[model samples]
Target: MNHTLTFNWMMGFVIAAMALGAGQAQAAYVIPMIGGAQLGPMDGTPMKHLDISFDGTNLSVHVDDMVPTPLLRPLESPDEFDPAEPWAVLTDKAYNYQYGWNPAGFITLPSNSAIWVQRLSQDSGLESYQRPPASPPYASIFASDGDIWQWSGSMTHNVYAVLNPTQSVYSASYRVYLGDSVTGVALDGYGSDDVTLLFNATVSAVPEPGTAMMLTLAGAAMLRRRRTA
Candidate 1:
């Protein structure tokens, strides 16, 4: 009888462990890039205004041109970039939430114009898990116009360990559309050379229920073992 009971209990524990591991929730939340403009120009030109958005996988750029000129284009099949690479950074602000921005870098425009960027993220209470890398730096893209833009170039941000609700932080990199409005920059107090890139991102994390259940089961097992001994 004792052996049978012990075997049943061990089996229960094994099942609980498997359930906890499998119950994790991996989710990613995306907020489109809206309202932005370039502040300065790299070639000494005035700033520009642009429109941008993300498809949770890639960036979609829309440029407001006087004619039918395509301002920017996204890289085709850009699912090759590593998420762990630090292409941007988030600043732990004086407030509760951190500031998110893109890393400073060059993206080839379809119009053959290389534009600098400062990608900005919407204010959300998302936590960071690791420090941003130094090589591929992130930058701060301020909000201007109805689209996000950069006057001079890409910006760099430093990542800090964030206490995310899901206890997970994941990032991926890809090339997307970047556009600018010829007239909106100056009106929005930005230069006309900035562009916004859309990205298709996917993030994952463990759910809370599974974690809590596992902890409870562990404690129970420990207590049982102590009583039996």
Candidate 2:
């Protein structure tokens, strides 16, 4: 066997092996949802729940429940609401249902992906969106459970293209919010206005360096055998 040809073959094998190993090593990345109800004189305690997971190509989001506390101040008239906003605006305060209470935080993910609804609980007032407005950055909104003031159920949202092999491992971010209403509404100040929920997710991919190295070594061993023959 020609020396040059043998070297080429060996390199190819090593590359292949490394790729394989790296791919196997790649695993999902999980992020936990952290937050709960917010209580204040002007604000009502609404429970927001979330669970998220990412397997490189797809992102799964689940909403456990969203319940608005009766303690919230009710709107005096319909004119206090804003129809143009993606979220609900009641009276002078704006209730952000598009993104969870923490609008500043978001999950990282890839671009140009579509969201698939796997499960939607009946009567669970939850609305969803791929992208939302800019003001208060948020991934999607799990709208209210219809006319019902409180909601209890789970819904799965699968977001595709969460990770791209060609781009950096962490390239995109996803923000999610779950609330009782798409547009802010008046709450009757009453009991504990606590929002209870959970959010967890993960992102992952196969690495290439290690796998490539293994392939190269294998190729070299084969090449040696050929030479001996």
Candidate 3:
């Protein structure tokens, strides 16, 4: 009886250890279409809009035409674009969305220049852009959960185009990565020619929790047979 009880205790520990270990291991989560976007009117008010994306690890925001100042730089190069400093925030224009957490600070645009925010983790490591949280100072917002976002481009020329602010046209060429650890990617967009908005981007992950549970149960049955032998 004593030996049998000890064996049962060992089995319980083995199960608990395995579960905890698996949880600690890296897992991915993807958000299909995070939330809706709000672009300001073309003529009357200075428009503000947000484009969000996730690569299982990071979140990015693109604030376009939030201010009406002439674009200091060209729109063709979407990767190197940066927001104007001193943070000119346009309250009249904004895009709201929920990604499992209440965001603290929002990416601000002065309506003059184009700016995009991206989050990357050290785990993503070096030039390899993957879906990871942004390091300090680079992020205007700190997300609580696993989130990733990217910026495509802005609509600066079409002054009268705001009544129907189309998604930026350049969003189609952009690529999002998760980390050096995984691969296999897909991308989507929001706007038209010369301008494109990246509505959202996501990378697939391991089987969901329900599927994992089923696998665990199956493994447990096999373990029981070995223990009996």
- lDDT per model vs. reference: 0.32, 0.33, 0.30
Better of 1 and 2 by lDDT: 2
* Ranking of predictions according to TM-score: 1, 2, 3
For model 1, the superposed segments whose C-alpha errors exceed 4 Å read 1-195, 203-205, 208-211, 219-229
TM-score of 2: 0.23
Ranking by lDDT: 2, 1, 3
Worst lDDT 10-window in candidate 1: 31-40
Q: lDDT winner among the candidates? A: 2
Instruction: Give lDDT tens digits, candidate 1, residues 1-229.
Output: 5755655566577668667758855433221111111111232222222334333234444443432211111112211223454421322111011223332233333332323243334223322222233332433323322333332333222232222222122222222333343422223222333233222122224548844565566667667987999
Error of 3 at 12 (Å): 24
Residue runs of model 3 more than 4 Å from their true location after superposition: 1-215
Cα lDDT of model 3 by residue, 71-143, tens digit: 1111111122123521112111122122121122443332232223223221110111111232322233313
TM-score of each: 0.25, 0.23, 0.17
